[model samples]
Target: MKTDDPTMLAAHDWDFPVPIAYGPGRLAEMGRRCIELGIRNPLIVTDRGSRDLPFIGQLQSLLENEGLSATIFSDISPNPVDSEIGLGRKAFRAGGHDAVIAIGGGSAMDGGKAICLTANNDHDLWAFEFEQPVPVIGQGENFPALITIPTTAGTGAETESTAMVTHADKGMKFCVWHPDLKPALALLDPELTVGLPRTLTAWTGADALVHAIEAYLVPGFNPLCDGLALEGLALIAKWLPVAVDEPQNLTARGGMLVGSSLAGIAFLKGLGMVHAISHMVGAEFNTQHGLTNAILLPVVLRFNLPGQEEKVRRMAQAMDLSDTSVEGFIAAVETMLDQTEIPKSLGEIGVPADCAARIADKALKDSAARTNPRVATQAEVQAMIEKAIAHAR
Candidate 1:
C-alpha cells in the first residue's frame, strides 16, 4: 500500500478574484452555491423597480426549495442613498441573514455591498470612505457572505469591492471600499439580462464602454488591465448596437455581459475623467449613471485622447475601425450614440447646465479624477461639463 508512484497527481482547485458562474441558466445553480457558502438565511437586496420582477420570485422559490430562507429588501433606489442601505443593514441584522443575494443593476448591487460593509461594523458608514490606511474589516460572520447576480452589464459592481453610495448630508456619492465586499460568487446569467428595456441596454452598454476606455487611458503601467480593457472594448463595440436593436439576442447579451465584467476587472487599474464627471452628476441629478456616462463620453474623450495618437491607434484597432486616428475613433463613438439613440447632451437628460461649477468642485474631489491622464483644473472640469451639456445641442 506504500508503493511510491512517481506519476501520482493530486486533485487541485482553481478560482479567480471573484468566482463567476456564467451562462444563460446559471441562475439554476444558486441554491447549491448558497449552501456551499453556508448561507441558509439570506437577504435578497434589489432596487424598487426590480421588486415585482419575475426573477425575484423565481430566485425566492429556488432558495426556499433548498430549505433556505430568502427575504427581500428592495428599498433601494437608483443612485442608492445612505438611508436605504442603513435600512438594509437593519433588515439584514434583524432577519439574522447569513448572506446577501444581491440581484439587479448597479444600484442594487452597490447597495448590497454597502449593506455588507456597514452591517456589522461599528463605525458610521461615511467614516469608511476609502482612505490612506483602510479600516480593519473583521472577518468571519462580521461580514455577510455576498452573492451577486447582475441584471445589468454596467458598473461591474458584482466583481468590484467598491460601492458608491450617496451621503445624504452632503448630497454626494462616496466611494466606500473594502476587499471583503466582493461577492463570493457572481452569477452572470444572460437570460436575466435579456429583454432589458431599450434605453437601459444602450445606456449600460455605453457605461461598459467608458469603463474599458477610461481604464485603458488612465495613467497606468499594468499590462494585464490594458489587455483586458482592449478585449472588453472590442466586445462592447461589436455587440452593444446589436443588443439595442435586437433586444433578445442571446449572443449579443452574453457578449455584453462578458465585456462588462471584463471592464469591471480592468477598472481595478483605476478609471478616469468620464467616471469622475459622471459620479458627481449622477449624485446631483439622480440620473442613470450609465446614461450620464454615455452623454459625457465623447466630450471627455476629445479632451483626454487628443495628444495621444499612438494610444488612439490601439483603441481604433480594438474597435475594428478603419481610420485608426483619434478623430475616426470619436466618429465611431458618435455613430454608436446615434445608432443607440443616446441623447447627445446632458442638457437633454434634464441636467441643468447652470450647475457646472458645483459639479466641477465635487468632481475634482472624486478619486477617479486623480487618475485621469490630464491634470484638469476646476476651470477645466467646468469647461468640459459645459461643453458636454451643449455637445450636440
Candidate 2:
C-alpha cells in the first residue's frame, strides 16, 4: 500500500495456485474464459443477496452473448449446510450445466465446490470428508471446471480446495477436502466489491488479516507460505482501514482483494485455533465468520504467539510496527478493532456465556487446531473462549 511510484494499480493475470484474473471490471471477460474451459452451459452458484445484485443479470447476458447458457442457483445460506449442497447438486443436474461459476462470498463458493464434487457421484458426502479414516472412492473430475468470482475479499474460498459446510444432523461445521475441489480460475474484480457494506468490508478485511496471522504462526517449514503470509499481513494492515473508510477507493479495494487472496493461499499451509474456534462458533451462533475472527484474534494472539520471538519480530516488521514486539502488533489489532467498530467481546455479539465447554469441545475436534503453534487442551481452549465471551480483550 506504500510505494514511492505513486501509480495506479493495474489489472493482471497470475497463476500461483490457480489462474487468477485480478483487477477492476474483469467480469467483462468472464464469457471468454468460459469458452476456453469448453463450458457451453454453466451453473452460477451464489447466495440470495448476491443473486439480487445487478451484475448477476449482466453476467448472464455476458455469457449468453458468447454462446454459453448460464443458469442461476441462489438457494445458499451464510454458512453452507449439506442440504444446500444437495439442492445445488440437484439444480446442476436439472439444468444440464457443464461447469460451475461461484460468484459471492465463502458460502456460495463452498456450496459451488460441494455441488461440483458431488454432481456426478452418489457417494455419501461425509464419506469424503478429510478427517474420515477411509476416503470416499469416487469423485467428479470429468466435469469441465469450476470458476470462482469473489464479491467479498475474505475467506479466500476462491483459492481453497476444501468446502466447509455444516452437518445438519451433527450441528457442527466441518470441511471436506479433495485436490479436485480447487477452482480452475478465480476472477477478482474490485469493482464488484465496492457496493459491499462498510461494516462487511471491515469485517472481511479483518478476516484476511487473521488468516495471514494464523497461517504465519502455524509451525511449518514451508518458506513459500511463510513469505506469502508475511506479505499478505503487511498488505491487509496497510490497506484495510482505507477500504473500510473510503468504500469507493479502487486502490484500497484492490489491496484488500489481493491481500485476502494471498492470505487464503497462505492458509493452504493450514490454519490454527482462530479458524478452529470460529468454525464452531459460527455453527452455533450463526455469527459472521470475519466478525468472530476479528473479535477472537486479539485473544488468540496472546495465547499462541508469545514466545516465538523470531516469528514475532518478523511479524512486527511485516505489520510496520515501530516497537517490533508482540504487544505492538496486538495494539495494532486493537486499533483496527476500534476502527472497524468490532465488539469488544463475543458476548456483545451474542455468543452465549454458558456454551464455552460445548464450543471448545467441538473446536478441538476441528482440524485447524492440529497446526496451532501452542497445542491447547480442552480446558485451555474453554478458558480462552470464556475470556473472549467476557470481553477479556
Candidate 3:
C-alpha cells in the first residue's frame, strides 16, 4: 500500500500518539507499564465511587506486589472543578509521587492530567488558557509521565491533550489544552467496565457517539479523522445498546472501549455544535456529559441540517436507518436515545428555560463552537438553546 494512496490515507495520517493496549484484563499490566516508565511512586487519581470496586482494588494490589507504593486520590467529583484539581495537585506533591495513573471515567482522567500539569508548571492551570493570538502554555515542555486506565467506555480522555475543568466560582466548564496533557500510555481494559451501571453505560456510550458524529460533521474533514469518526460511529451504533442492556457482555464492552478511543482521536480534527451546547448544559445543570450530549444531539443535527444534509444522509446509512433524509437521520438518533433510556430534554435534567441564554452565550465562546459546520451566531445559538429547552419539555 502506497502511503499517499487514497486507499491508505486513513492509515497514513492516523496517528495513535500514545501507546494504547486494548483487550480484556489489559489493566493488569498497568503496573508493568508504570515500571517501564520509571515510576517508583504513582498516584492513582480516581473518583470516590470507583475506589470500592474490585477492579480498582486489584490494580492497587498489583502495584503493591510490584513494590511500588500507589496512593489513592479519590476525592474528585463528577464535574471536577478547579478546587478538586488543586487538592489533587497538593496530594500529588505531598505524596512525592513520580507519575500519575489516571483510572476511571473522563472526570478522573481529566483531573489526573490537570494535576500532572500543575505539578511541573509554575503558573496556575487556568493561566494556560489560550487567548486570541497567544497560545496557552509554551511548546515542548514536559509534564509528569502519565498513565491512563479508563473504566468507562466514553470520554476518551485517555487519548486527548485537553482537560475540561469546571470553574471554581463561575460554574462553567473551561478547557486547558497543551501537548503535555496527553497521557504517556493508555490501557483499555474492558473488564474494568463490567461494573458500570446501565444508565452510566448508556450515557457514556452516547457521549462517544456524539464525539464521532460531531467530529465527522465538523468543518475540517481530515481524511484520517473522518475514517476514525465513521468507524467509531458504526461501533457505537452496534454495541452501545448491547452493552447497556447486558452489563456482562464483554464483546460489547470491548467494542465501546475501542469506539471511545477512536472518537477521541477523531475529535483531534474538530468537534461540532453538540459538544459546544452540551458543555454549557452540563456545567449549568450538573447533568451527565453523555446524557447532555444525547439530549442535544438531534437538535444540533437539525440545526446544522441545511449545511450537513449529505453528511447526515451518510450517517443515516452507516447507522443502518431505513430513511436517508436529514429528518430520518435525526429520528434515528432520537430512537437510539430512547432505546438507551437517555433523557430527551434539558428540562428533564433540571436546566431552567431562564438559564438558556446564559448557557448559549458561554457556548458561543467555547472553542468547540468555532469549528461547528455552521458557525453559530449568538442569536442562532440562543435559538438552538430555546429549541433544546422546548424539546425537553
Where does candidate 2 stray beyond 4 Å?
1-8, 133-141
Question: 1-393, model 1: which lDDT tens digit per residue?
Answer: 122212111111225667887777778888998998888999999999999998999999999999999899999989999999889989988998888888999999888998888887776777669754567765543677888999987877787668888888897888987765667888888889886999999999999999999999988589989998999998889888888988987778888888898888899888888888899999988999999999998888888897889888998899999999888999999999899999989998888989999999999888899889888999989999999887742
lDDT of each: 0.86, 0.86, 0.81
Question: lDDT ranking from best to worst?
Answer: 2, 1, 3
- Among residues 3 or more apart in sequence or in different chains, the pairs in candidate 1 whose N, CA or C atoms overlap within 3 Å are none
lDDT of 3 by residue, 1-393 (tens): 111212211111123767777777666676687889898899999987787888778989999888999989988888788888899889988998888998999888888888887875566778756432323454544577888889999898787657888886887787776754667788888878989999999999999999999889877539888888888898788888888988987878888888888888889887777788887777777788888888888788877877677787777777777898887787778888999998777777787889877888889878888888887788888888887777832
- Off-target runs (Cα >4 Å) in candidate 3 are 1-15, 130-141
Q: What TM-score, over all chains together, does every model reach?
A: 0.94, 0.96, 0.92
lDDT of 3: 0.81
Model 1, position 335, has a per-residue lDDT of 94
Highest TM-score: which candidate? 2
Decide which is better by lDDT, 1 or 3: 1
